[model samples]
Target: MVPRNRSVRRTKAALQSALVDLLLEQKNLQSVTVQAICDRANISRSTFYLHFENKDEVLSSYLLQMIGRVHDALRAWTGSDDTRWTVYFAHIAHIAPILGSLSLDGGPHAILSRYERQFAVIMQDLVMPGRVPTNDTAVGYAAHYLSGGLLALTWWWVEEDRCGTPAQEMSRRYHALCSGQLCP
Candidate 1:
């Protein structure tokens, strides 16, 4: 759990930012080390340890915060599917830069088979028609499949500059799928 003290928050944020900057620079997790993060963040080992156990903890904490942001976005919109999805698309689009940068330098796959299972919990809580079972059920398969496709498409949409307005374009595509117009 994160401490409520302001100083602790700053320390943790520093560690998280340092990890990201290192990951972006090195392009892989294996290349990142606690010492590198400490050096980049400008925090000493004692200060870093006061907040996190290791570099992976920092990375996981950062990822969890990101996922929390997505959930917060989901909570902020409650309307028609198109409207909700448009808002969500806009939110995720703002996060595209990070995803686009995560090509990972030819290792530690980009949300392919690697992140699919882990991302399913978040996806299942999202716009599926019903509660998606987490086990090896058919519904679970469909949910993971959809999430993987969505993740891949988000990375592509941003990396390739598919459209100037991602929210609108992605929302249009969503409605088309809902209407059985896959080509649209």
Candidate 2:
């Protein structure tokens, strides 16, 4: 059972890695095919189908996995120290390729539109832990606003060519914005 679980993990990792490689090379997800993914991953067609329904499913799974990591990091953060932004920015920097690929060809826009509600719920939980907001609608709106602003800022940071800003500076700017010290 242990070996089987390891094999399953290895196969999924191979598939995910292949998809990322293809995404980087092509810069477009629409052009990527299951056969191409299978070829890149050196997995048979039957095996690919056994694991993922399609390329989009693979991409979605990868995004969810990445988000889970961010959530875990956020949960582990201790104290009210503003350095949490640094950790967040560093995670974003670490996943530059995924961000770059998603920012291209209106991919970010599509992703935000599709996942807006889900992201809002997650952000709200993160920002307001334990106690529920008195007004659910108001909290939902705030979550949407914050999530949209953060996504836009992230896309800008990732896409900017002249912006050689380090993660620490970005983190400081983010903290400033949250504190109303920097206007959006």
Candidate 3:
């Protein structure tokens, strides 16, 4: 195993924090530049380049950290199949603050596609242990359908002012689907 470097880690964190603070005021990621980030973080250009390739990499790294936390929470639920979905959603709830706060460049559709693919991998692992299904067509179909449904629900929850009805409806629909019952 390689040795850990504390100073490098601290510089990376400084850059990330600066980026987040800048985004909060800038509102659009495109408005920020690498020089601005380096300036705010009080690091040399070479230092920034050493840690990250560019702005996108820096932002992606920050987002991935948040995703990693959720991933850990998901992995921790290594229990019965009955509680898999429950634990998954519970983890989502735990990370709702960070997830909701994320403002990415791509539109919601693009983001959800990535989200679904990632979750599909996680779901397959949780459902099948060492044997992840390799049936491409089936996996694609399931990922598309499930991602679309989840994305639609997530969109409404994020965009619409009303939350109670949409959440209740989703809960009912999800329960019905999981219980071998389909809803129109």
Query: Could you estimate the TM-score for every candidate?
Result: 0.69, 0.83, 0.64
Q: What are the lDDT figures for the candidates, one per model?
A: 0.68, 0.75, 0.63
lDDT of 2 by residue, 1-184 (tens): 9999999989988999999899889887777789999999999999999989988788877877777787777678784545665666777787766667776766867765666666566668777665676357778787888677767777787777313677667767876776678633
Q: What stretches of model 1 exceed 4 Å from their correct place?
A: 1-8, 21-36, 49-57, 111-114, 129-136
Evaluation by TM-score, superior candidate among 2 and 3: 2
> In model 1, how large is the Cα lDDT of residue 42?
94
Per-residue alpha-carbon lDDT of model 1 for 6-81, expressed as tens digits? 7788888988998888776776677778999999989999989888887757866786787677666765667666
Error of 3 at 65 (Å): 2.0
Alpha-carbon RMSD, each predicted model: 3.9, 2.7, 4.5
Query: What is the per-residue lDDT of model 3 for residues 27-132, given as tens digits with 9 covering 90 to 100?
Result: 6577788999999999999999999999867877776676566567657866554444454355445434333445344444555556676666654544444553
**Candidate 2 Cα errors over 4 Å, as ranges:** 1-5, 133-135
Candidate topping lDDT = 2
Cα lDDT over the full model 3? 0.63
At residue 78, candidate 3 shows an lDDT of 64
